[model samples]
Target: MKLRAYLLMLAVVGIWGCTFVLIKDALSDASPLAFNTVRMTLAFLVLAIAYRRHWREINRHQLIAGVIVGFFLAAGYQFQTAGLAKTTPSKSAFITGLVVVLVPLFSTVKALRPVGARAPRWNAYLGAFLAFAGILLLTVPAGSGVLPDFNAVNSGDLLTFGCSVAFTLHCIALGHTSPRIAFQPLALLQIGFCALFMMISTPILEHPQMRVTPRLILALAIAAVLATAAAFSIQSWAQSILPATHTALILTLEPVFAWITSFLFLGERMGLRPASGAIIILAGIAITELIPQPHVPTSHEA
Candidate 1:
């Protein structure tokens, strides 16, 4: 079952990885917030219909959990989309991948305990370090070297960093809540509330504009149906069985998938450095999965 959860998460990230290009293309025809609102709304409507019978099962705990998680979800997408509009895809991918590191950091917070945040194992930390290093190599331009030019910080990078934090919280929130609530209700409410938040924020944040182009429609359909609805549902189910840190570590593959998609569709070529980085990332994941975990005594046992 755990292996199945991991495989599901892998599939979820793969779907997400393909969306970077689609979203970039869609942004050409719609403002970021407007596009987000539309995609999320479409996703919510789809989930609502699919899980129509489960609406009555949602209780107050589920409602609160959904709202909290959905707010972070909306915030994460808002930052990521807006940032993508302003930054290069490589930079955006690297910054967004920082959630791998952020998850363990945020999980250590005492307040987040109610949301199922656990102190990551030592191997998880080591894995995150290697995975982040790999992400740096994979996403950083060849001539730019391993380190990003801090002196060249831009609004887009800052926004994408915000996305990393928001996504970290979203993961922890979902990890805690998913196991406690029914999957159908949990998935539906989160998608519904995320759409509501995006809809509410679109006008306040930007001048909403969209051109009804076929490209835009195609992006919306793929993003809403596959990426948002299906992917998020799978994530909720998977996270119920996997720890948030483990989930984030697996998600580090997103940039790798993005790179593969870019290579296949946009004729981008991977250099030696990125190829090596991909290998190191796999090594990191191996270490995390294969290393023996130190058993900690529960409070009662202690």
Candidate 2:
């Protein structure tokens, strides 16, 4: 069961990785808020139609929780899409990948504060550090076979970092909220609320408009159906059985996949450094999950 849940999340990561190019393309024709509003609304409408029979099962608590969770979800995508407009896909990916570190820190702090959660295992920390380094290599342009221009950091990097933080909160929120409610209904409500929030905020914040072009429609369909609806459903159901730290570690592969997709579709060259970085990211995941800590005897033991 645990293995299946991990695999499910891996699939979600794959779907999300492909979305980077699509989103980057879509944002050229529409504002971030406008694009997100339509993407999420389309996702919500599909789920609502499919699960209309279960709408009555959602309670007040679930409705409220879903809305709260949806805010973070929307904020994450909003910041990510907005940032993608100003940054390269690889740079945006690496910056947003910081959640691998944020999730464990958030979990560790929460555990220390008498929150009933245990501190993250040591392997999780190691994995997060390794993944962060891998992402750095995978995303940054090479100079002298290692490292990129640190001065390349800009407003887009900062915004994508905000996206990372928001996504980390979303994962943590799911860890707390998913087990208490039906996954489908909660996911529906969450997507619905996200769409509503984006719709309400788009006009106030930006000049919102969407062209009804075929390319735009295609991107929206893929994002709304595959990335938003299916991915959220998988994540919500999987988090019920996995820790947020573990989930974050697995998701660090997003940049690796993003790089691969770009190389294939966008004709971006994948050099040796990024190839090594991808291997390291996979190793980190393996070390975190496949490793076993040494057993320490308690005082009562012989």
Model 2: colliding residue pairs: none
Q: Whose TM-score is greatest here?
A: 1
Spell out the clash pairs found in candidate 1.
none
The sequence of per-residue lDDT tens digits that candidate 1 reaches over residues 1-302 is: 99999998888788778888778878899999999999988988999898999988988989998899889888999999998888655556656766655555555566664443356678767867786677556545454665665455577767877887787778667657766777788778877898999999999999999999999999999999988777767776776688755765677677777777767776666578767766666666555545432211000000
* Backbone clash pairs in model 2 (N, Cα, C under 3 Å; residues 3+ apart or in different chains), count: 0
lDDT of 2 by residue, 161-231 (tens): 78978877776776577657777788788889988889888898889888788878988998988887777
Quote the positional error of residue 177 for candidate 1 in Å: 2.1
Overlapping backbone residue pairs in candidate 1 total 0
After superposition, the stretches of candidate 2 with alpha carbons farther than 4 Å from their true spots are 1-11, 111-115, 127-151, 235-250, 270-302
Model 2 is weakest, by summed lDDT over 10 consecutive residues, at: 293-302
Which candidate should be chosen as best, given lDDT against the real structure? Answer: 1
Those runs of model 1 whose alpha carbons end farther than 4 Å from true positions after fitting are 1-11, 114-118, 127-148, 236-250, 269-302
How high is the lDDT of residue 146 in model 2? 55
